[model samples]
Target: MTVPVSPRHDETFVLNLGPQHPATHGVLRVKLTMDGEYIVKAEPVLGYIHRMHEKLAEASTFAQFMPNTARMDYLHALAFNHGWALVVEKAAGIEVPERAEYIRVITVELNRIASHLLWWAAFLLDLGGFTPLLYAFDDREKIIDLLERITGSRLTYCYMRFGGVYNDIDDEFIKGTRDFIKRLRGRMPRLYHDLVTHNIILIKRIKDIGIISAEQCRRYGATGPVARGSGIDYDVRKHEPYSVYPEFDFDVPVFNEGDSMARYMVRMHEMEQSMRIIEQALDKLPEGPVMAKVPKVLKPGAGYYYSAVETARGSLGHRLVCNGDKNPYKLKLRSPTFSNLSLYGEVAEGMLLADALALMGSLDLVIPEIDR
Candidate 1:
């Protein structure tokens, strides 16, 4: 919802945020019934970039839909790739090798860092700070370049197959990841101190603004930092124990205050946590082929299968129904941003316009994910 000027009789009027590509992240338009600067009611209008991916899934071969997964959440595209691969593997009873699993974990964690970094940059830009974007990108470039070396493309990657990954990791990838970890680790303090923690303007703007409680998150089915920030420890990685995440030791960050600042801190802490996972993966890097042996033609004898993974945004779930065909008869994608964005109407009701914007930014939404 947007903030408009004062009206006569304290009359409530609808304010359109966007169906255009301004600061609302994507073409998200929030129709706000405003009673002179305060939102009386909030309703989000969606479907600006709806691609009907589920219908496309019915037409394409199971493997052909790999690229489509990334389109929904480009920031965490690898997680989408991994999620799709996971469901198909489960459906067909394909076993990923131990080495492939390690490679997948490492690459996914790096992608997670890149996603969080971009969100950090964009969220700061929404707060009117431009410099953070540069620093964030400087570090993020290393991850993109590293992934591109193996995945062949940078942003919307389709590097995962049903049983394993597209390519194996060489020493180049291993060393590059190690160097990047060192580089980014040294820069984390500045990110926290200079731009966030001690900045009075940011603190005053976000500290107690747009509070979302634990009850609110549970009610809304909010996950990821949006849920964790509100003291709900429901990370798919930890709670569900997907991939090699159970082997890694990292604490989920939670804040009881549940304000925009709490969300901000959660992501900042998560970046560090992601680094921990990547470091452990690199050290335990094994030797083997990345891709597993599978039938040239895939025909799963499946009724229904579901798989979930922790994307940078939250829990990304893929459900498929196969009638012993090469293509899925039914497909469902559960995007985290959609659920997180749904909470906006309730949380943003009485917040100041600027504060509401900050809270929305804190959610770190990628609109294509919501629209799809």
Candidate 2:
């Protein structure tokens, strides 16, 4: 319970909640105006890690810009890769092979699980629970290993190409993925939910804290778990129906409470849904060539094209302007975290300092994506 404080306007002090704080997850700083233990205002300071990604996109060719997408959201790089590939394909009128589409779904889902595991570990660490981090990382490593076997990089993967993917998944990769899925399914109920999610302390810390209404989510254009937690059933994969997502049957986890715990629970349930997608994709995996045949110098006819993908964070969109050239005339990236963070100033007002950080953690921000 928050006790009301009667203080003069002059009594407030400014606090910088880090461009270096561990709880921030990356180079993000919140300028907090405080009146005793309560927050007066919270403004997020961005561009500490900006890499000029959009400008780089303009300069590089369609193929050259593929690696740049991975750097924006390092945790779920494949989603960025998919968004770029999709926009290019949409503009160039390239048709992907059936087998490649399944591969894309499988790999992207695995990346989503890895991204969530890291967020889970880090969010628990923010709330002063260290044990969950150990278990989460232990599980995340298995995904990294599986992805590394095919993608060739551990962290920022540039796997997806313009039409399909760069390579194919072998039987060993298939078997490893199935075994990991079974292992995580057996462990989540006991190790994750029982050990952490239903804990009394966690509930107390987040259950009614950082309330974001459904209206506020819409106002801020918040997507993924943040919007779903606030009772918005808008998912790019489902609503827009991209790639092979139409074939899969999975529920978009939603919680109407709209608190920090609600946001946390949405992500927890989403991991299960992602697993379901991967399993279905694997079972229905078609046999054929992975990459599509293309011209030596690619050029989409002069026009504009756009594509959006549901990443671990939220909806990542790629808008491209082509002038019948190999290079994109203009490239605009709409990163979800940028819009999500815009609501912090409104949400953090009057919150306790500790609770505000908890609220920020629940947003699961990746600074590079926002800064880019």
- Candidate 2 global lDDT: 0.92
Tens-digit lDDT track for model 2 on 83-171?
A: 99899999999999999999999999999999999999999999999999999999999999999999999999999987789989999
Measured on C-alpha atoms, candidate 1 has an lDDT of 0.87
Candidate 1: list runs displaced more than 4 Å: 1-10
Clashes by residue pair, model 1: none
TM accuracy, model 1 = 0.96
TM-score of 2: 0.98
Q: Residue 117 in model 1: shift from native, Å?
A: 0.9
After aligning candidate 2 to the native by TM-score, how far in Å is the CA of 363 from where it should be? Answer: 0.2
Encode model 1's per-residue lDDT on 1-372: one tens digit a residue: 234434454577788888774569889999988776787677989999999999999999889999999999999999999999889888888998878888888999899999998998888888888888898999999999999999999999999998789899888999999999998988888775675667998898789888898898888889999888888888888887876788888888887779888988888888888888888888877788777899977898969998999998889988899999999999999999999999999988876767788888999899999988
